[model samples]
Target: MLRLVTTSLCLYCQRAQVTPLLLTRPHSVIFQEENQLAVNALYDLSVDISKVRKLKGWVLRQSAVYVSETAALLRDMGASGPVIARVLELHPEAILCNPDQMEAQKKLWMSVCASQKDLVGIIEKFPASFFTSSSDHDNQKANIAFFQTLHLNKRIISKLMASAPHSFSRPVKQNEEMIQTLQKTYLDLGGKEDNMKIWLQKLLTQNPYVLLKLPNALHDNLAFLRNVGFTSDELLRLLSKLKGFVTELNPESMRLTLSYSEETLGCTDAELRQIVLQCPALLYYSVPILADRFKGLLAAGVSMEQIMETPTVLELTTQIVQYRIQKLRSFGYDVRSGSLEVLNGTKKDFEMSYGKLRLRQERPLFNPVAPLRTED
Candidate 1:
């Protein structure tokens, strides 16, 4: 009897252990079926399955119904098949969004977009922008309303939504503070009220991301420039040239670049200011890049004075400078003896200069009074 009781107890413990596995087996199979179905649906859409697997495997675990639903909504919105596939592939998280949330997002976007066709185009180009989290929907709506109150063009608002969506994800107060700071800075820098609205619109159009920057960044950069001896008029001009990118710069980085440039060019404070004014890129390019460019010019027998006279040459890469130098040398127009201005411009400009030099070389320095006879 004792042996029989011990055996029965062991059997009961074994059965208990097996019960949970038996219960979970069906659920695991259901998940696998769902994942496989999702994968098959996406594969049918011509999405690059290998990329989705590597970058967003979680998308497979989502319900196949959601994937199909999202794709169907995009199709209904006039998105082409390829565009829908590209959108899903680029932003797999979009599959997790529910139907109502997507509709709400679509409606919000349509407010700024000129038409459903335009909205579809924006979505096709910037899929991630259109598929932002539902939690940001309120903030996005608020930001759009605020921008409209500022009298910004619908086209500009559309661009901001597509290119700088994160700017809309923040609280309206954050954006409002930044805008107020810009306005104050403009007026303080001698900008007139009549031109402020146009100035703001142009600046925003040039760089919508500027609104994302901290207000203090603009303040600090302007203060640094003022300390560097830029008068009110000159500061306003520099701001216009930078196109609101000054907000992206901190005083520390500008100080470092200015110091390095002053030391490298061996110029006084006033002259350094003038160089920066002439070529805003001096404030933008990194030290190592600037060093390499200066080294390349000096290595090729170009004088520092020539670079000072034409600061824009620093914008060219070392390889381009070398290529242009060689091309000029082949034409007997040595850059060392000639002006560095010859090496500064687009490929077309360089080619035009080369063609003119070639013509000059082919022409006779002293033509006789008689016209040269052509062979028939």
Candidate 2:
């Protein structure tokens, strides 16, 4: 039995007129289990309930019982109120009270009410109307109460979110090591200054998805830095030199960057050509259609800038075919896949060797499969 050592009067035991157990002797009651390990199970907790001391006052005792029962029920329902409250009690300072937290709460509530009509009905019909008039302070309080009511077993969620405010406000430090590694590798490989920029751009474009995994504030800062030309070719060359010494790495990991230059600065044919001049490795093996488009555009007196912005000649031709296919499909006609290929092959031969596509009516051959026999 647990002993109470107190100078002040124990009100609970006073009401029951029962003596608070003193651990002077080694007398053991049924409450003191010989098999202490058995208490690990809930069934053990239930088995020993009879030996537990009852609280004074029927109303208070009944309320305590009901609360305990409800808490257990909520636990089984996967709702966690008591645990949330305990977590908050443990780290009251971490509780969100900022304007951003308030905004988040408002957004959460809005989304919940909008998507869940049943939740709306429950909120409206709940006996106390708990959610009806939630002021900012009340909202925060209610949020705490709601979490506490969920009966969460562990304080994992609370602990995880506890450091969020600090994390959100702080900027992540740039990895100088990665920058150095990139520089060393490229410079050691004899990559020219101009080539590094092209390499970086290519890396950024092909791996735009990297931005999503990055911490947002840091990513925004990096984007800003890039805009101001912080990621210059000179810096990249220096970093490339640093990369030569670093081993046991893919070397391309740090290359995963956002490709803002593609859409913003515009990766025109001229720019691509510049990259190719600096780094021949960057060139595609086959871009015949692209080359032809540029050639045609140039021949037609179209400026390189204009041609770059407009769809390529091959792309435009493909678009035309696609438009025709879509129109035909809309009119209850299905296109066979190989039909376009045959037409394209014919058109290619005609346009290059003979002439452009022209209307040519062809004589039909005698049908091998005759029309179905019609009888009156």
Model number with the top TM-score? 1
**Local accuracy of candidate 1 as per-residue lDDT tens digits, 86-199:** 988887767666666788988998899888889888887898798777778899999999999989988899998899999998899999999999888889989999998899
* Residue-by-residue lDDT tens digits, candidate 2, 58-136: 2122111112222232244343454423322222111112223323433444332423333333322331121111233
- Candidate 1: the clashing residue pairs are none
C-alpha lDDT score of every prediction, in listed order: 0.82, 0.32
Error of 2 at 76 (Å): 43
Candidate RMSDs in order: 10.8, 20.9
Runs in model 2 lying further than 4 Å from the true structure:
1-174, 208-376
Ten contiguous residues minimizing lDDT sum, candidate 1: 1-10
